[model samples]
Target: MRYVGWTILITFWVALGAALHYTLPQRDVVRIVRVFEERQDLNDWTRIFWSRPDEQSDTFISRDVQFLQTVRANGRPMVYRNEDTGWSWPPYFKFDTSNLFTEAADATSTRAAPEWYVITHYGWRNEFLTIFPNAISLRQVDGPDASKGIPWVNIIILTTIAAIFYAIWVRWRRFRRARIDPTLEEIQDSWEAAGDAVSEKRGRIRRWLDTWKAK
Candidate 1:
């Protein structure tokens, strides 16, 4: 029971540390998208890109076009798309000139823009912030028509889980150490005393010849 208690306490501390260390940026992607929408006033130009009136179906169908318009409206500083040959607009084009942003392409088929597709950008390098400004910059730099999902979703999830376990393991170790029967110093002193007692019983002459006697 005592050992268990110690383990739990140590585990708690370790888990706390790991939890702090392994924090994930809270779903910034959605927040960033919202910010981009608001800053860029995407609603105004959404019609120019889509032209359709319906909400769900139209929005889904026109995502590529709308995204493209947003990038272009933002000064074309930081977005791009994969323009391939085939259906209407492009096939797949990587944008991010700096080579730091990751892109994913979404394929959408329509007569107006055959190659039209949505591209999502993620994993942008911090250095590009000077020019791009926000997450939208990365999307723009890469290309609007590009359709890629955010890159690190799985990695973030795994890292979070690992952090939790790591924290637990660390606390457990700390607890175990705390519960140990004899501390390092105590063990060391006990051994030293035993040696000194043996030497002292040997005789005065032996003690004098010993290292302690010399000191």
Candidate 2:
């Protein structure tokens, strides 16, 4: 009974916390650029799309699309002046080079130029890669990414539900065993051990046995 009460209390607190999270305005920016990738036999074209903070619709930008085209044609890396600096790409795709679009910029790249469309914050860019690992060409909502160390409210809700059911099951099991074995100590031991046992018929039988024994 005590364990059950504690479990219920814990579940309530968890549920309340999750509700708060869902209701609160998202302080962290949920930004993602929808890179529409169209891979053809000859070339792969990618259109860059960006979303402002909590914006309903996304805006299209062509920085990545142009870079991809230029890189594909040149075979050598094309330079873009980004943030008053210049950067080059490797012949092959490396994990280090994967972030080239976001951070480094070429000396010739202008901050206000069309070429820097995909050069937003790393957070937004990562949001894009998370949803569309192999995305071809289209807009996609950036769903939750578990690996990013962000606390997911959905996971918390599920865990709370599981805890509630588990508590109920354990309590019911203890209640049943107490009648069959007819002892408090044994019931306590079994209840602690079983941790998840609940049957309606067993409960009814336990009640009948208790009444019969009492009479």
Best by TM-score: 1
Tens-place lDDT digits, model 2, residues 98-188: 3443332231232233231221111111332321111111111232231233345446756886799899989988887877556767778
- lDDT of the candidates, in the order given: 0.38, 0.35
lDDT of 1 by residue, 23-134 (tens): 3221121111211111222344332322222344334422332222222223232332211112222111323322322222223223333332233432222222311111
Kindly report which residue stretches of model 2 are placed more than 4 angstroms away from their true locations once superposed: 1-147, 180-215
RMSD of each: 17.4, 18.2
Q: What's each prediction's clash count?
A: 38, 12
Best candidate according to lDDT: 1
Q: Which stretches of candidate 1 lie over 4 Å from their true place?
A: 1-147, 181-183, 202-215
Error of 1 at 52 (Å): 44
